[model samples]
Target: MTLRHHFTRLICAFAVSACLSQVPAFAARQPGPEQDAAQQLALQAQRAQMLSRYQAERAACMHRFFVNACLDASHKQERSALAPIDVDLQAIALRARMRAAEAEMRQVQANIAAAQTGQHDSAQAERQSAARATALAQREEQAAARARQAAAGASKVAAPPPVRPETAPPAPRLFPAPAPQPAPQPALNPAQRAAQAAQAQADYAA
Candidate 1:
């Protein structure tokens, strides 16, 4: 009977302990939004740090493996001697995932650069076209001004009246009028006769 009583007390104590354990000891300490955010931030920070470490490792591994392999392609033995990183497994797999991420980033950067180049080229082409159009319009205006000047000049030059040479006045004779002749010298004064002879000589010369 004493043994049975001890066993019953033990059972009661165990049952009370179990019920107490079911109740929360720190019901007032429920997690809040701030605490959850802090916890998430800490977890993300840890993951980022780990990712950086992995990146460094991957870079080193790539430098030791693929970089030299590509550079030494002509040297078959050197290429063969260098072992493959076997990046399909283990820590190498993690490196590969990082490389994939880097490749994606690089692709995005390249796309941006290409788009910028295209925009610049299009802008340049538009400017050139505008300049050409302006120059052509100016040239056309200048040519029009020159044509107007030429037309005005042509209109100012008057045509001469038709020549009437066939009905022109007859030309006048060039000879001079004859003067009155002195009476012929008849065996008279010698001075008068000599003067008359000299005048006759001059008239014959003329």
Candidate 2:
């Protein structure tokens, strides 16, 4: 190459290398979504600046006597400058995809936990409802028994008392009478007594 071509090639290589070196390295810690987006924007801006510089160099190379040789040198420098920026962009895209996958997994777990809780609550409610129904049935049975007892008592009170048959009075008892005795003779006076005595003696002698 001529002295002038050598000078031009050296200047272009140095400028491209210096510009690419100005791009900052990624931090050790993983970046958040906003940080990733900012990094991508900054890298893209640097890439655009690098391309613009290469285009200007290419235009200058076209006017040279060794156009092929100048163009080849410029293309090599452009590739070297763009290589690091492309690597950083790829890393950012990969991290973003990982973050999205993790978020989706957490959401799925939350949905499963919510469904389990709903099932448990539904079972508890059903148990409470069944217990209430049992209590109500028992109360109804007790009321029915009390009503039956009350009806039986009322029936007994409404019934009339048993009646006794009427009977005749007892007849009086009759006894037989005693037999009658003969009447006693009356006593006479003194003369009548003596005549009775004489008549009794004469009758005895005869």
Best by lDDT: 2
Relative to the unseen true structure, what is the C-alpha lDDT of residue 134 in candidate 2, on a scale of 0 to 100? Answer: 100
Predicted candidate 2 versus true structure: per-residue lDDT over 1-206, tens digit per residue: 34455445445545544544454442345788999999999999999999999999999999999999999999999999999998888777766655665565455455556667988999999999999999999999999999999999999999998787877788877777767766777879999999999999999999
- Spell out the clash pairs found in candidate 2: none
Model 1, C-alpha of 159: deviation from truth (Å):
5.8
- Residue 174 CA error for candidate 1 (Å)? 42
TM-scores of the candidates are: 0.34, 0.59
User: Can you write out model 1's per-residue Cα lDDT over 1-206, one digit (the tens) per residue?
Assistant: 24345445445545544543353521223244455446546655655565565556555656665766544443453333222222112223333333444455455556666777989999999999999999999999999999999998887776566687687688887888789899896776989889989999999999
User: Residue 66 deviation, candidate 1, in Å?
Assistant: 51
